[model samples]
Structure formats: structure tokens, C-alpha cells
Target: MGCARWARRAAPARDIYLTYNWKWNVDEEICGICQQGFDQMCPKCVHPIECKPCVGECKHTFHVHCLDQWLLKRNICPMCRVNWVIFRKFE
Candidate 1:
């Protein structure tokens, strides 16, 4: 089976929750966006941001403000060039 099909089949049963051990106090060392090592701020805007890893299907995580600016120029994801779908709900 193809990777995408495999991912789709497995996704429904997978738990997406992220858990951390607060006993070690490691939150300060992790990046909120990519959930990896500490990321540096953008020099142009002075906003902290994490760069997505090169290998992945959905490596499009970014700061809301920074990504908004980026999306203005292109509709596809910066890292993967995959078209993004926007959904807005009215409450």
C-alpha cells in the first residue's frame, strides 16, 4: 500500500495528544511550533519562529503572524508547495 493510504488508514486510530513530563521542567527547552529544539526569532520581525524539518508531508507549522505574511504571496505551503485549505466557521 502507498504511504498516504497507510497514513489515512492508521490516522483514525492514532492518538494525536502531546504529553510532557512536567517533573523534569523541560517545557522551557522546547519550541512551541515544531515541538523541537529552541528556534530562533526572525531577524526581519524579531518574532521567534521554528523552521520545519525538510522531510515530512505536513511541515507547515509557523507563527500565526509570520505565516499570514507568507501566505499573502503564495497559497501553497512554503516548505512543501502543497496547496492549503482554509476553513472558517461561524458560531
Candidate 2:
């Protein structure tokens, strides 16, 4: 029936909206890198890329390129010096 088809379509739209809201909320609170609340930045680097959260526990979000370069020099977090290897294991 027409009603059944409309209901099916509406269900998916509602689900998509709910998912978007949840993702938005999570991204706002958690850092993409450290997976923790927003923290400080690396002193050596400047101009982070749009403030995306770090994907680790240090929760110290930073610019992608800045953190990438820093990691090349050291395997530990700049803030807490937590081993990158340990962080990877958790992921």
C-alpha cells in the first residue's frame, strides 16, 4: 500500500537524522586523536587543521601535519609522554 511505502522511507530518514545527531555530539566532546576532552597543543607547531580531536588517550588534539611531524621525532605524546605504541594497542 502507499502508506506502507511511505512509512518505510520515513523510517530510514529518521534513523539517519538520529545518527547524525549522535555523531555530532560525540565529535564535539571527544578528541579525534586522543579520544579525550580537548586539551593543549604542541608548542613547536602552529596552525592546527580545524581542531579535530586526537585519536588517542592523551586527549591532546592537534593539527594533523603538526602532530605527524612531531611523531617522527618522538614516539611519545608531547603532553604526557605516553608511549604511542601503548596508545595504538588500546585502539
**Candidate 2: tens digits of C-alpha lDDT, residues 1-91:** 8887667434443433332211222223434344343333334334232333344465444434455776899887666788753222211
RMSD of each: 20.2, 10.1
Cα lDDT over the full model 2: 0.45
* Per-residue C-alpha lDDT of model 1 across residues 1-91, encoded as one tens digit per residue: 6776657434456568985432211223433333443344433445232332121135334434445666688876665678744332111
Q: How displaced is residue 33 in candidate 1, in Å?
A: 12
| Residue-level lDDT for 49 in candidate 1 | 28
Highest lDDT: give the candidate number. Answer: 2
Estimated TM-score per prediction? Answer: 0.33, 0.36
TM-score of 2: 0.36
Worst 10 residues of 2 by lDDT: 18-27
Cα lDDT for residue 13, candidate 1 = 67
Among the numbered candidates, top TM-score falls to: 2
